[model samples]
Target: MSNSLQYIFGGPKAWDSGLWTASDDRVRGGSSISHLYTHPTQAKFYGHLDTKTLGGAGFASQRTVGDLALDLSCTEGIKLSLGWDSSDQTFTLNVKDTIPGKREDGRDEAGVSWEYDFKAPENGGEIFMKWDEFKATYRGREVEDPEPLKLNDIKRISLMARSFFDKQDGDFKLYVNWIAAVKKDDNDSDDDGDLKKHALEQRSDPRPVWKRLFCGLL
Candidate 1:
């Protein structure tokens, strides 16, 4: 892993079906979201949003392995490749606190302590979500300027694509790959204590008598 960032998910393999669940019920006219086996190299997530439900509010989401530790500190943002089957949808990315329920395997939901989001416009394009542009919301309200990620404490990441306007009926498909955190070089300390101490002593602190004598001879 880089000192600044690390990869969490969205590699070449398809998602493990047992770990993913979908919400198809259109509460207030919401559309159903589901994943399909596209080809050996890609997985496709597609669904519709209801314009009639919640007065035109719609949401659809897909989640992956939540059991791994995510390090986000070295990144300025996230980078990913995206392509849509159409040209009229935008996607939102969300991270949540750990789910408390139990799955069939008898493990409780993982803790998701943070979140970041991005909007993918309908240009069949890719996006690099910048850290400054990422809005940090907790308990439903925005947190005013949070600290940079520590990368060792991430719980989960998610993606959602919805209709900007309700009653809009069109088929949408979003393909994703190479989703990762991008690193930024900051004043990070290297964890090597011996190296750091040696450098500090050599630069400013006084040398031992033998070393001083050697320097005198030189």
Candidate 2:
């Protein structure tokens, strides 16, 4: 039997009240925006990325809301079924284990985060991330030393379109079929067969696409 991957977001549930978008325009004094549009079989993340105002540093993103509390300690990492149009741009997947209480002034307290960078495939493909592939970051910069990722209490997962220090900018689109917690298949030779089966299952699913494009946090 193949190792089963559990859908944490996307997949049959699709995007609902559990997702939201945030952009650097919040703090950078820019006009860049990000949006998430959900379909029956996929979610599309598209937006304009403006780096000029921030001097080659700007970002827009979508993230899971509330405490997911996803216990992925037993699994390897994440597997994303995705498609994209921008080959030169890089995207980031971020995970956080802790959500600090609000400060005295009502601002959020910053916490450590684990991040992984990836380039989208041309037509669309599966991207697998191993647990160790994540790097720790604090206040947007990589840290030399930080506490290990707490998989058991993982609170958030996010997808970001970043300027990468002026390397990229402008409009971007990413199509996501699903995001799941995956374990490496012990039987690597059957990988192609498993993927074919997954495609067939997706085609057979009868869920209808909700007309609404965006869903805020519940």
Model 2 lDDT on a 0 to 1 scale: 0.72
Against the correct fold, how does model 1 do in TM-score?
A: 0.60
Candidate with best TM-score = 2
Model 1 lDDT at residue 1? 42
Residue 168 alpha-carbon offset, candidate 1, angstroms: 6.0
Please tell me which predicted candidate would have the highest lDDT against the true structure.
2
lDDT for model 1: 0.51
Clashes of 2: 0
Q: How many backbone clashes does every candidate have?
A: 13, 0
Tens-digit per-residue lDDT, 1-218, candidate 2: 56567777677666663466563454546667888887767888888899888787788888876776665654678989986554457888999998767877755666677999997898789999988999998767898978889875678888888877788889987888888887445554246676566546445545322211111000
Off by over 4 Å in 2: 84-88, 100-107, 184-218
